[model samples]
Target: MPDSHSLRIVHCFRAPVGGIFRHVRDLIDAQVAAGHKVGIICDASSGGDFEESMLGEMRGKLELGLERIAMQRQIGPGDAVAAIRTYKIIKKSRPDVLHGHGAKGGTYARLFGSLLRASGSRVARFYSPHGGSLHFDLATLQGRFIFCVERLMERMTDRIIFVSKFEQGVYARKVGEPRCGHALIYNGLANREFEPVTPGPDAADFLFIGEMRALKGPDIFIDALTRGSAMSGRALTAVMVGDGIDRNHLIEQAQAGQMSGNIRFLMPMKAREAFRLAKVVVIPSRAEALPYIVLEALAAGRPVIASQIGGIPEILGEASPALVKPEAESLSGGMVTAINDLEGFQQLLPGTQVLRQKFSVENMAMRLEAEYFAALGR
Candidate 1:
């Protein structure tokens, strides 16, 4: 394994936005502190100047290197061209371990890692699904095709790292039990993230910070906001912070509900910065593989009302009051209750000591570092 602290690690992923990017950045920071050299290879086509500045900060911390290549989001002939370019970049980096963060990243990591082995290079290949392609169901043609690709990719991978047990279970049910090594590791919060955040004097009543996609249930949030306001008999303001393809649709939904004046849409920023603008964090996701918002909000001592799906229950607890069904009516009811009883809802949040015991970046990095060495047959 070339010693844990001295291993050369390379991470490949499609975009430098959202949770996957955050996960990789935290990992690289910890790896560097532990004396490991790490590099990143991700899509340059997606992020804007803000994301680029974040990546620029990443470059200062990474000891191995960084490569930003033009990559597409969906499958096409262009993927072959992108893979060849990514392979050349990875090969030149001479990494001891190649870790793929999402679907496209996993595909490139395994195929190219295997190809390198064929040419006498030694490198450990690991994939973390992060609810990418596995969200599709086998009842559909695309789902079956992706599942098949996953099954084939297993042969080349040394180990598959599932960020949540819910994700691991879903992959097993959809793609079948893994033929190679696998582990269930929960996503962790940084030490700084654990410090409580005090909302500004002009803080809103609620905050929604994530992609504007329907999968994240922003529509449900908008609908519930209107419904909650009606039920409470007063106007409640909220902020939606993020950008995605679904932004216009969500905006229309908010406007159609006649709550647009009460809702504010801001571009994405650091979660901590977003926290300062709202007293409570709302995670209305229809599905997740242990979202960082849940941990981050809880760590910052904010109450959360999240849908009871995926690894959310695992975080908020099966019987947690914050857990609600992923529907507008249910969400509305939850919202009304939260507004009517803010103090009670605040009391229901998971304790800081409990969160610290369950999700910490130190634990996550230490376990992953050991797993990387183990995958090398050390």
Candidate 2:
């Protein structure tokens, strides 16, 4: 194995947005700073100028380089072509560690890692689910199929990294305990992120700045915003800053509900920038594996209101007022309370000092680097 400090790592993932992208970015930044060779291979179909800007920032940081191509979010005929293309790319990079984030990325990384090994290449294969297909109920056919695939893929995985304990436990229960190696590592942020983001002069009352999808609960956020405003007898202003499969639909719904005056839709930007534009940040995701938005918002000293699903409780405290059920009505209550008494919710947030100790990019990268070396039997 190469020296732990000089390993070649390639990260594979689908979308270059949301928490998964943020998680990879934090790790890549830390790893690159540590003088390790790192690269990224993700989908190029969705992101616009926003993702291009993110890639531009990382150009010099990734010594192993970046390759964005045709990658799909679902399993289909296109996957075979994509996989062949991905295998050829991985072969050229000659990565010491092929670490995959999300489902499709996991499949490609592991399968290609095995194929490389068969051709006498030594590469440590790692997979982080990143709240992928695991959200499916085990009772359904799709859930059962996904779980079966997970079991088969375990054979090719050198180290399975679960970003949160909730994800680890869910994988264990749904797919049965993994027969191979695994570790639970929380998503973390850089030290600078823990510093407060002073709200701008024209900050909105609230911000919902994640992917525009039903699963992430953009619809629920609008509903909660409408309800919260009605409950508090105020026409609160908010911003929805992201684009996705449901962005236009969500915007139309908000407009139809007569919220055009109160709600504004915008494109995705840096989380820090989003923080500065809002008094409070809200993550209404229906499912997650410890979202970075929650950590970013809290670290920036902005009050957060998040759903009580997946590993959110681990960050927001098990009994935190910010943690609410994944329903419009439940979210509305939190919003109403927060909108009516922002200072009260502000005081309940966990301290930045506490977060600094628990979630640091340095710690996360060190642990993951150690895992990579271990996978290579170094």
Candidate 3:
């Protein structure tokens, strides 16, 4: 076997944060631990949000270096220059494998990679959508156009990696199969620091982490909770974590629903802290490709009430038969049942330990290393 020092990898992504960033960060950390040389290329647009901190922590902890491309939210001439800068970085880095994450990274890496591969370079390109534009159902004309573009660009990909089988299936069913070298890798959780803290006496009864976006279902989640009689009055309290453009509207909804006293809108939380304090973790996301919150919640021995969407089912498996649809009534029922069956759910804690083992970053690293070798036909 080649020493880790002999293995070289370049991971590319947009501005930091979210599952994709976490996934790449874990990969870089593990690779470094195993003695592999890892490099990250991204934009330098951190307002120090959760994503920024995750990437920043990697820079601090890992000896690996980063290349930051000047970028912004909107596309313009600057983006083209950023892409060129990325190409230059990849050329100079000369890694054995190039990993592209999310939409911007995947598109740029795929296009530049096609150029490199056409020139008979030894580098192989792998793309992970990380819940990008590719997975969403864009049935409209614009959506169709984007899908076509993705299919065209996919031809340049050496391997298409999906964070969840549900995501992989969505792409494969629409774009094609795994014959083009597809692998389903679940997002890994930092399970080590996720041990349960003593439950807080004054902690919110339910915690909804993640951004306050519609797809994340902040409004829907609040609505569902309101519908449930169990959640009525100040008997049950909730904390809404993370902020977004929709925070005001979500707050408005919470107020209008007469849940103001019962629901507290909290700023984003550190992962371990959130998991520690949460009694019943709510993942009210309308769509998900295996959320880390669900994994983290279960690892902390907290019962999770999540929508039956995407890879969530894959993670929860058959443990919670009350897995509800992403609707007000259904999700409300899930929340109530989770609370009612907390002990039964707690009985499943042993299984969560087992599941945690499977989704740990270390195991993900080993699996990914194997996948990379297989992709290279080593």
Question: How far does residue 373 in candidate 1 sit from its true spot (Å)?
Answer: 0.6
lDDT tens string, model 1, 187-243?
A: 888877888888999998899999889889899889888988888899988999998
Better of 2 and 3 by TM-score: 2
Ranking by lDDT: 2, 1, 3
lDDT of 1 at 146: 90
Candidate 2 C-alpha error for residue 182, in Å: 0.6
RMSD of each: 1.5, 1.4, 2.7
> In model 1, which runs have C-alpha deviations exceeding 4 angstroms?
1-5
TM accuracy, model 3? 0.89
Provide TM-scores for the models.
Answer: 0.97, 0.97, 0.89
lDDT winner, 2 or 3: 2
Candidate 3 C-alpha error for residue 298, in Å: 0.6
Residues 1-378 of candidate 2 have per-residue lDDT tens digits of 246459889999988888888889889888877778898898879688998898889988988788888887778898888888888889999999999999989998999999999999999999999889799899999889999999999999999999888999999999999998999888888888877898899888889998888989999989888888888888878999998999989989989888988898999998898888878898999899888899999999999999999999989899998889988899989888887788888999899988888888888898998999899988
